[model samples]
Target chain A: MITRFLSEVRTSFNPFSPLSKTARTFLAQLPPDARATGMLIKHTILPRTSTQKPLLFVKFKDGKELKLDLETMRSTEVMAEVDRHSRILARKEELSG
Target chain B: MPPRIRLQTRQLKVRIYHHQIPSQPCFYASLATATTPAPPIEQTIHSVSPIARFPPTQPPSHKPPEVRKSQLHREYQSLLKSSPLVLIFQHNNLRAVEWMGIRRELAIALRKVDAELAATGHKDLYADAIKIQIIQTGIFASALRVVEFYNPESTELPTQHPSNPATATLAHGLSRQAHEAASDRKKKLDLAPLLSGPVAVVSFPAVSPQHLKAALSILSPSAPNFPAPKRKANPSYHEPAVQNGIQKLMMLGARVDGKAFDQEGTKWVGGISGGLDGLRGQLVGMLQNVGAGVTNALEGASQSVYFTMEGRKYMMEEAEKGPEEKKGGEEAKPEGEEAKPE
Candidate 1:
């Protein structure tokens, strides 16, 4: 049963598909801490669902792709997150200096 | 309550006396004073915003969730005393809209700083620099939780998973635990403050020359010092329509202290600091314990798992005991522990 389930998951996963490829490229190419990143991703990625959009993606420094939904993209909450990251980056730079 | 108006100045009378003899002292006590116009008994009524009249509403005395003032100040001073100053702009009391504008302005100013340094043949001095950070303390519950991160060099904004009302746990411990776990992850990267620290807090309705000057001063510490810049003459003062419009807009609501669209003033509020890492760790642990409990409860509730407070608490207790029992068995009798099968 476990082997069958693994095979099913493996068969379903397709990075070569247009949507997946686009998302992966978007995540990799965009710089961190941009105001336009969310909007750009939303517009660029075509939603599969008729009702609403699915999760967007962002890449971290270590090349980790984090999922963010439409609400998160539009929310002013991003300001707080961005501000926090800047401080951390600043601290890192300071320590390195 | 009707706003109270205060009289600005008192009327005064002056008498002029020419040289007079002792007996006829009043002889030259001038009737000439009558030629002088009476001091205008004009009352200049300066209207004060009602928000200014009353004290800011204090958070509950037990403990406010925001960072403390002293810590921010300490951090700020320490940064300042360093070889190169870390010029931080701490913003509190900004509404959502004003914060957006200020952030944009900050980005532009940073770009301009780079340009100016390069233009002035100070390329080498660019290495000796200023680190600019803007901290927002208003509107959020936890001071340590970073809502957003921006880098001038970066092309995109990085945000964390936003808190949602639906998924939010009712249990204070569990909710706090989740927040701490998340905040800890942010803090480890130095994105969030390690503890509440002193911050140079300022309130300005919009970005102006003063902000630029402050940035410039910090960015080029070796530059010639000039006398403090004169306060800019408010154009609204000359234009009554603009002033009236501002007052009307302020009255419409979302006034920061009842004085909305206040493009005139800037002030430094006190310092504020973030929470401790240890607190975050404890909360993270609690969150894990609660999560395990919730999972187990869900599994056991094959018929129905009610996500009520009591049910969650019961699960958490159950979850808490399982780990301890496992640990005890393993420590007490390693062979027997291995022999036991599910």
Candidate 2:
């Protein structure tokens, strides 16, 4: 099953894809450790199929990619989790500064 | 020694010379110390004084009484040039010296003295002493007037008497004209904004730190919100009175200064100097913008050197050719000239 997933990701992956612009910028801002290891599996619209939500691929340094359900990502739970993480990050930065 | 009574306020210093003789007795009070050595009294001039609500506690007096007297006399001498000795007295009763009542009566007498001085070509007498006498003969009370005091100690004598027919008429005429002019001017004007006063004259005697705090607390705009800090003497804990006083003073200053104590705009409606936080924020924001602009400019410095040079040359050419040339150019375009947009 893991082999099949890897094959599927390798086939669909496009580094120069239109959606990659925003994703790349966001990844650039991440800490060096997070950029190298962490995966942000998001379901967003591609340039070719802007009308429909597609399974978008972003490659971190790590070989294993976390598979995210497109429907689940849009849920209120994910938004709340993101907001909480952002607040924590901001507090950490404030303390460190 | 001679039943001398000294009354000192922030500005006025009253030294009652209550002599046995009512006619010859002199009542002297220093009007104002308006010169150097001791500063001018802020409370006397401005309604809105920038004095600290709770001033620092004065240290205990250690100097000898004689030293203090001489020091006071020296201070008075410094003020004497600007504010001369005012003689205020009451007839029939030499012993009774009503300081407050005498002050009121003397104020009226000074106006008359000023009129007389203006009449006698003594406009240059900036700090001349005005002698004021109050006589209560019977039930009938006459209009208050100023008279020249006959002091045997001083060489200067009154050249013109207030009772003199010619001088009295002139003084009366001058005073009437002055009142009429003042009334006319007052009718034309409505209200004037009182500016913030100078640093208050922190003098000793009568006006203490506690008195100042109380007065300021009563008059201060922030007195309602902060309310004066209550002193709780906890016997168990060694509460330093000096520290407590300093802390209270700091709090009062912060409250009066407005932005130091509270970030919330609930307390004071900004002082004459304005809110410090807002000012700091503005300064920070301005500096940040300037820094960002400089950074951006430095980054793009290599991109447009040629265009900047060309622009400078174009500006010089435009400046050299006067408005006439521009008008001529606008009126009729030459074949070589490029079409210019309005």
Candidate 3:
């Protein structure tokens, strides 16, 4: 399931897409254990032209892209934190029954 | 000879009594006196006397209390100058709807900052920013009108007062104008489609600073729906005209009866003419949309069902009547009534 999710992410991943640089950086920073199965989701973009932040698109295992604002360090940090939490949980479960 | 001896003895006795002769010194004292021959009594007295009588010295001088107090005062002034006080301006003239949008955007931005701080364990810094007073400016007229939109917390100076009541009123009126202009811009954004998503339209009257702050505070994505303003006794004069105009325009497109849009359209027009004094037209527009959306959704569903049920009932009634007509025709034939051949 993990391999299949990775393959899907690889297929739809556009390195040069018009996402925020911060979002791209966050995606690149995803650790080996961070990958999860999901659908590809597009980010929701605000209409304001002055907004310089890049929106983030996340693909869930179900193939849906969740739109989020990833331009801010705070938002990106949250995502990273959540990933870390999930990794910890997975490790703990593996160690248990 | 006898007489001379007697007189001399008498004179001697008288002299001895009159002189008050000191008692004979003790033998030991007499011996010591003779031996020392006098270390002079003056020398002994001088050796026994202690040193005395130096002129008194002056006390050490110190700074005056007034000088010290003045120095402290100067230091305090300098500290005050360097550490500026922040004041937040809450402008009241903005419609609540617009204020809500601005508030949400600000909350999102602040939350983003807060989250970053949390990640880096800089929560203390985030907490400090949250405590800062957010000053909102009231509606101002004149050249200073643009300053109303500035972040009150970021402003360094106080706003200048109007010279007279007339000018003050003008400034207030100008702010209202600016608010209307802002609403006009939002009006162009097709909000109906956006409503289905996470985005919401928050508005405020540009005049009230407190209302603006409330709007900003709750504009976050995580924040719950913004509260509607309390109903006021006097209807806003501008609300009715704008609502009527919009209603007329909407009527031109399609005719709707007994639907949410119709109800909203009526209420909006009525709200403008007779409800909520000082209400912003843009707010009325928002309320109308909200009310209409809910009404339309329910009414549309019910109408769809009603039409389907009515059509089925009509069809069934026709089907039942068909057998009766056939029976009547058969009865007429059996009775042998003269059938007129046409």
User: Which candidate leads in TM-score?
Assistant: 3
Query: What is the per-residue lDDT of model 3 for residues A3-73, given as tens digits with 9 covering 90 to 100?
Result: 22221222121212233334433433342223222322222323323335555544444344444564444
Mind giving the per-residue lDDT tens digits that candidate 1 earns over A1-97?
0011010000011121222322232232223222222222222322222233334443444233444543334323433443455456557667999
DockQ list for all candidates: 0.01, 0.01, 0.01
**Can you rank all candidates by lDDT, best first?**
3, 1, 2
The RMSD of every model to the true structure, in order and in angstroms, is 33.8, 36.6, 32.8
Q: State the interface C-alpha RMSD of candidate 1.
A: 18.8
The sequence of per-residue lDDT tens digits that candidate 1 reaches over residues B1-342 is: 643775444523455678674785355665535566644443223222222322334212222335565344324333322322122222222333444443343345545645655676544322223333443332121322322211123322232223322322222211333234435544432212211121222222222233334433322222233122122622222233322211111100011221211111211110101112334676888999999999888777853545566778888997998789888877767666566752
Off by over 4 Å in 3: A1-97, B1-281, B329-337
Model 2, position B213: C-alpha lDDT score: 30
User: What is the Cα-based lDDT of residue B275 in candidate 3?
Assistant: 21
Estimated TM-score per prediction?
0.17, 0.16, 0.18
**CAPRI classification of candidate 1:** incorrect
**Per-residue alpha-carbon lDDT of model 3 for B269-302, expressed as tens digits?**
3234212333566687889999999899999999
TM-score of chain A of each: 0.38, 0.30, 0.36
* Sliding window of 10 residues with minimal summed lDDT for model 3 chain B: B246-255
